[model samples]
Target: MGDDLVDLSEMFARFSEHWSPKLVARLNDYEVKLVKVEGDFVWHTHDDTDELFLVVAGQLTIQLRDRDVVLGPGQLFVVPRGVEHCPRADAEVKALLIEPTGVVNTGDAGGERTAIVVPI
Candidate 1:
């Protein structure tokens, strides 16, 4: 399989549900994930790893204690470990998530909204 030819649009077309992350591909020790999101999510932090979020479609608003980040297509951000963050999309948003292999969506702030990490 060609990584360059691996289309995000095709992978994204597979899921229509919200907050459920789909395993996409991987780079080194990190696994890339895709999730369709809408509505508000609980604030949480990954005490173990930095998490990367790349907006693939629609819009994503990330809220922090101090400020908010608005992401559009091609925009990306990294949440450093232990920094509180909540992600919300007024409408359905598609995103590419990145972090170490086995990293949980909610991290140590676990509750619901967490998907079992798939082995690549």
Candidate 2:
């Protein structure tokens, strides 16, 4: 089981929806997920957990209340707990999200864009 690998290419190929995150792997109590995002995302805050975003392909801009942080491929950014933020992309972007289990994607702002954690 430990020898098994999860291929990002294969997982990304199977999904095309944007903003929806799919579970890729788990370590201890943390979850590693892949998400394809484009356009503007909802502004929200995870009051209890910090969120990590690692850009796998394309570019991602995380909009914070103070300023914006841009991330290219191989780059990453982390939003601290209770910090309000919104993620946006000029084109389709593939990224990896690392956060604790049970942390909702939409954070405190619950709406239709909230991801349902697709399991692959």
Measured by lDDT, the strongest candidate is 2
Residue 19, candidate 1: alpha-carbon lDDT? 86
What tens digits encode model 2's per-residue C-alpha lDDT throughout 9-119?
888998899998998898899989999999999999999988999999999999999999999999988899999999999999999999998889899999988778867
lDDT of 1 by residue, 1-120 (tens): 236645789877876878887777878998888888999988988888888999999999999889999999999999888899999999999999988888778767788777775422
- Flag regions of model 2 displaced more than 4 Å: 1-3
Q: Lowest summed lDDT over 10 consecutive residues: which window, candidate 2?
A: 1-10
Clash pairs, candidate 2, are none
Cα error of candidate 2 at position 1, Å: 10
lDDT of 1 at 66: 95
Model 2 misses residue 112 by how many Å?
1.0
lDDT of each: 0.84, 0.92
Model 1: per-residue Cα lDDT at residue 70: 97
